[model samples]
Target: MKRNLSSFAHPVCATLAVGALAVLSGCSSSAPLFLSDGRATTLVQCPVGSDSCSQQASASCGGAYDVVRQSSASGTLSLIYACRAK
Candidate 1:
């Protein structure tokens, strides 16, 4: 008896194509890693066990008179940072 294998191949190819498209889209998507409203400053640094980054962000806030804390996502990042006034 003979059996056909083309049906299995079709699903495998489709899955691979979808995965490739996802990877390519992830690579090509362009968005800023940092952005701030006019009231805050941007800081890129470790605030590990301290509030250094947030403090600097506050100081760089151009006297906006608001309390600042690092965004929740801040600590999850593994990168050194700089400051920018808004």
Candidate 2:
């Protein structure tokens, strides 16, 4: 007897797609990581050459911040910053 494998494949494919999306959602750059000094740090991603990253850093720190690192990749600008003291 031949079984219908197509029907089984649909559910498996859908489950995998949903799982991938869920995992990707958590990979957002907006999520902040804590520094050893208890300062809040995060990777800010924005359009290449845009001031959005700096703006976000300032807002996140409420004024100034230190750039731990900066790089541009795949037409995206990224800045790793830690909030500065008040």
Candidate 3:
């Protein structure tokens, strides 16, 4: 007797797709690469008094690097910047 395969097909495919997505997401880096230097070299800290702390940090890199991360603690904002060669 012939049996229907559609019901089993959908759930299995959905399960496999979800699993693949999960694995791929986990493989992604939390902090993406911003420079060819292979590491973040410049760090800047901005006081919380300024509304543009993040902007200030980005500018502090002397227009050469891109800000890759920003964090705040103890009323101070911190940034990690990476410079890429032209």
lDDT of each: 0.53, 0.90, 0.70
Clashing pairs in 2: none
Model 2: per-residue Cα lDDT at residue 27: 88
* Top candidate by TM-score: 2
Predict model 1's lDDT versus the native. Answer: 0.53
Q: What is the lDDT of candidate 2?
A: 0.90
> Which candidate should be chosen as best, given lDDT against the real structure?
2
Error of 2 at 14 (Å): 18
* Model 2: per-residue Cα lDDT over 1-86, one tens digit each: 77699979989999999999999999886646788888877888999979999999999888989998899999999999998877
Provide the lDDT at 61 for model 1. 52
Ranking by lDDT: 2, 3, 1
Worst 10 residues of 3 by lDDT: 53-62
What TM-score number comes out for model 3?
0.39
Backbone collision tally, model 3: 0
Residue pairs with backbone atoms closer than 3 Å in model 1 (clashes): 44-81
Point out where model 1 deviates above 4 Å: 38-86
